[model samples]
Every structure is written in structure tokens, then in C-alpha cells.
Target: MKHIWPIAVMALALAACEAPPSQEDAPFEPQYLGIETRLLEGDLVNFHVEMRGARKTRDIEDYARCAAAQYALIRGYGFAQHVRTQVEQREGLWMADAAYLISDALPKGVTNIDAEVTVAACRETNIPTV
Candidate 1:
């Protein structure tokens, strides 16, 4: 019984050291690279979003879209219309350069995003928005 107690203690110590992966070490999710914004005109802004480990252009584009939506909210707009998005991969990281127009009314045919809702969605999906 004495020998068994020492073995159990060592086992418990090792188990404590082998902690599970934290949120920072999410293997299956794309990590945020960066976000940049430039005001082009009144209610129009250029957004750039880059993400590492994004397997597809859609992933990086979504990040950009999320950024744009959140930015519109920050700028006191209610809706964001996607003007254009250019996606590229460099050095194994995906980057999306996008343009958005913020407006009070939703545009026709374009994928319009509600500023508040999109920001919340980004947070829930682990996408960074600014």
C-alpha cells in the first residue's frame, strides 16, 4: 500500500501538468492576424483583415466582413453593405482587403449586415472584429 500511494501521487502530478488545450490553442479555428481600417468617404470605409491558418478565402473574407460590420456600428451606422472583397494568400496567411458602405437603410441585393448582430456573431464564432 505504501508503494501504491507514491505511484498514485506521481500519476496525479503528471496528469495535472498535461492540461488540455486552451482557447489560444484552438486547432480547428482560424486565428486573427490583424485588422486595419481607413476612411475613404463619408460612410464609406476600407477594411483589411488578415488571418493565419485560414484554409479558404471564404474564411478570411468572413473576417473582413465581420470587421466591416463592427466598424459600421462603431461609426454609428445601422447597416453595412459589402462593396467588394479581394482575398489573397501570402506566406501561408490569408488576407482580405474589403470595402464597405455604411448606411441607415439596407441596400438591395447585396449581403447587408446588421452592425450589432454581426458583431455579436463574430464574438460567438471566435472571429475578431474591430
Candidate 2:
């Protein structure tokens, strides 16, 4: 009887400590998906980003842009010019297919684009960038 009581208590404790599945475990709804980049040419990159857990279109686009900005910094660049971005939702995941031209200085005829500023904003918003 003594041994049985101890065994039951141990089993209960283990069960209580079990954690629920995290957002990454399941594929339903919006969760922040990570970015995949492909170098197309000198200073030009293509980014494929995904987000889950949020249904907002603008939020996903911002996540993609943040990724581009961070990527520019990774390549020793201070700015990135937006080439294009295509967004879509499939199987509950918001995907942003984007392209950018990274540059140490702003590309000719390009408006202001600061990688540091974009990365700061991404960190502020809890968005992952690389």
C-alpha cells in the first residue's frame, strides 16, 4: 500500500509537468513563419517568408520587409530597395514572396532606406529578422 501511494504520486507529478504543444507543433492559424533567401544576382536577393497566428495582410508584409532589411545588414549593407513582393495565404499560412536589392549606399534614384532602422522596428514588434 505504501509503495502504491508513492507510485501514484509520482505518476501525477509527471503528468502535471507535461507541457502542451507549442505553436510550431501545429499547422493551423497564423504563427510567425521564418524567411528563406536566395541570392539572384549581385546585391539582389529573393525572400520567401511565411507567417502563422496572425491573419492580417499588412503584418505579414512587414515581416517580409523586416527580413529583407536584416538580410541587407548581414551582407554589410546599410540599405535595401524593395523590388517586389507577392503575398498569399495557403493552408492557413501567410506567405510573402519578396525581392530586394541590397546596397551599401542607396541605389541610384532610390528613396531613403535604412537597414538599422528597419531591424530596430522589427525587434520592437517581436518580428524575427536575419
State which candidate has the highest TM-score.
1
lDDT of 1 at 39: 96
How would you encode candidate 1's per-residue C-alpha lDDT over 1-130 as one tens digit per residue? 7699999999999999997976346666667979999999888899888788876677888899889988888877889998899998888788888999898878786578888898898899888889
lDDT for 106 (candidate 2): 76
Candidate 2 lDDT score at position 46: 95
TM-score of each: 0.75, 0.72
| Candidate 1, backbone clash total | 0
Candidate 2 local lDDT, 1-130, one digit each (tens): 7699999999999999999977557653446768899999898899999887754677788888899999999889999988888999877778889898899987875543689999998898788997
Candidate 1 ranges with C-alpha deviation above 4 Å: 1-27
lDDT for residue 103 in candidate 1, whole number 0-100: 87
Clashing pairs in 1: none
lDDT: worst 10-residue window of model 2: 22-31
